[model samples]
Target: MADGETIARERIERLESLAREAVAADEEDRARSYVRRARRVAERHRLRLPRSFERSTCDACDTYLRYGYNARSRTQSGHVVVTCDCGAQSRYPYE
Candidate 1:
């Protein structure tokens, strides 16, 4: 492979590893950041990510769940119910 492709692959792998670590550490903010970075890398390479690249949505109210810098600043509580700035909430089975 070309040097650029190799570098992109390496960067994507590192970002994915970081994302997994952030999730395991229960650092939702950090995890979301890494996930976004990874997605960007994938897009740059014209590659497809395993999961949907779009933000998740709340079924009831149809609020788009934001991640990374776009996510709401509210601290998560006991469970993994993520809420968007639009006041829509949905639970995630992280644990």
Candidate 2:
């Protein structure tokens, strides 16, 4: 079980890195696919994604958020608002 968890964690990290690279390369579709795969791995393994990967992904549509591209970000009322291309919104508070 520990070894399985380790493999799952490694796969999640690889997927997240690939997603980021795909987004940087302007491949939104590929990025989204990577995000979906990461999510599936997490769910299957009953593992939680790291905070950074969670922040970079959209919960509603399973889309990877590329700042200023598929997603727009703004600070409003002491929270950061991220709006995804699929019309889903996520908010995070800053200190």
Candidate 3:
């Protein structure tokens, strides 16, 4: 992975961790902010962050798309493409 991707992923992870903590503490407002930031990070990296309110399944693998490495769609050919920071893309919308 490229330096940018690595850094972005790490930052997203931190944000997620913090978000979880905020939720556990019942700090809904702060948790929402963290979630917004996390969503921004995911968008910046073109990871197609799942909707905050949508309970959608992966269109390909049928796995529950989690945040970070958990969100992605596979091609019809069955490739485990990590849409976040893999640096090599195959089944993206453009291709």
Candidate 4:
């Protein structure tokens, strides 16, 4: 049997893929809804998202971010900054 964290991670992965597909199909609202659901799953299971997905989600509104669309990215001082449509900003350092 899978542990709580494992199950949550699987759900998050599935949701993220679905969100991406929705975005590719130009269904922005549907993608956002999927992202919101994924965030709730993570919260309920007390699990943190993987690093790759972490940068693709908005912390404030739980919306999935697509660069050059609903999200913007900029690099400064060795860090990549992501700004979401909901006015949430996240920074990650890259080497």
Candidate 5:
């Protein structure tokens, strides 16, 4: 990987950690900001966000999702369904 890619990855990691901390502290807006920034860095670097991070974020509102807190999760039709507080739903297939 290039130096830029390495840097972007580091930044994304940092942002993700900060976002988690913010969410744990009940600062939704701050966590959302971190999520948005991480996405922007990934886009600018043409890098894919990690799968876990992607699934833990709301695509519509860029908010960090905490299952049972700001989001709801259920299994249906062989897929895991995640629903955000903003009424957005994401489904991922399960084995």
Candidate 6:
């Protein structure tokens, strides 16, 4: 039987994929709900979100981010800045 940690991980992965599908389907509210659900699962399991998952979501608004849709990307200096529609900004450094 799968342990709680494994179950939580699976749920997180499922939620991530669902969020992507929701975004692709242009269901912004659904995508946001999925993101929030995944976050809750991770918190309950005492786990950190996957790096890709973390970067693909808005920390402030819990919105799943797509490059052109609800998100804008800009390169400044050595970092890539992603701005969500909610005006939340996150920076990732590029090599």
Q: Which has the greatest lDDT?
A: 5
Off by over 4 Å in 2: none
lDDT of 6: 0.95
Query: What lDDT tens digits, residue by residue, belong to model 3 across residues 1-95?
Result: 88888887778777766766775676656766776776678789976554432232233322323445444555554544544233333343333
Candidate 5 segments exceeding 4 Å error: none
Candidate 4 regions with alpha-carbon error over 4 angstroms = none
**For candidate 1, lDDT tens digit of each residue in 30-63?**
7667767766787798765544323353334332
lDDT tens digits, residues 3-59, model 2? 999999999999999999998998878988999999999999999999999999999
* Per-residue lDDT of candidate 5, residues 13-68 (tens digit): 99999999999999999999999999999999999999989999999999999999
Query: For residues 1-95, could you state the per-residue lDDT of candidate 4 as single tens digits?
Result: 35877878989999999998898888888988998888889888878877777788888877778899889999999999999988899999989
In Å, residue 60's CA in model 1 sits off its true spot by 14
lDDT: worst 10-residue window of model 4: 1-10
RMSD of each: 9.2, 1.4, 11.1, 1.8, 0.5, 1.7
Residue 46 lDDT in model 2?
Answer: 98
Residues 17-82, model 6: lDDT tens digits: 999999999998999999999999999889999999999999998989999988999999999999
TM-score versus the correct structure, for each prediction: 0.49, 0.90, 0.50, 0.84, 0.98, 0.93
lDDT of 2: 0.92
In candidate 2, position 26 carries an lDDT of 85
The CA lDDT of each predicted structure is 0.57, 0.92, 0.54, 0.86, 0.97, 0.95
Candidate order (lDDT): 5, 6, 2, 4, 1, 3
Candidate 4 local distance difference test against the native: 0.86
Full candidate order by TM-score, most accurate first: 5, 6, 2, 4, 3, 1
Clashing pairs in 5: none
Off by over 4 Å in 1: 50-95
Q: Which pairs of residues collide in model 1?
A: none
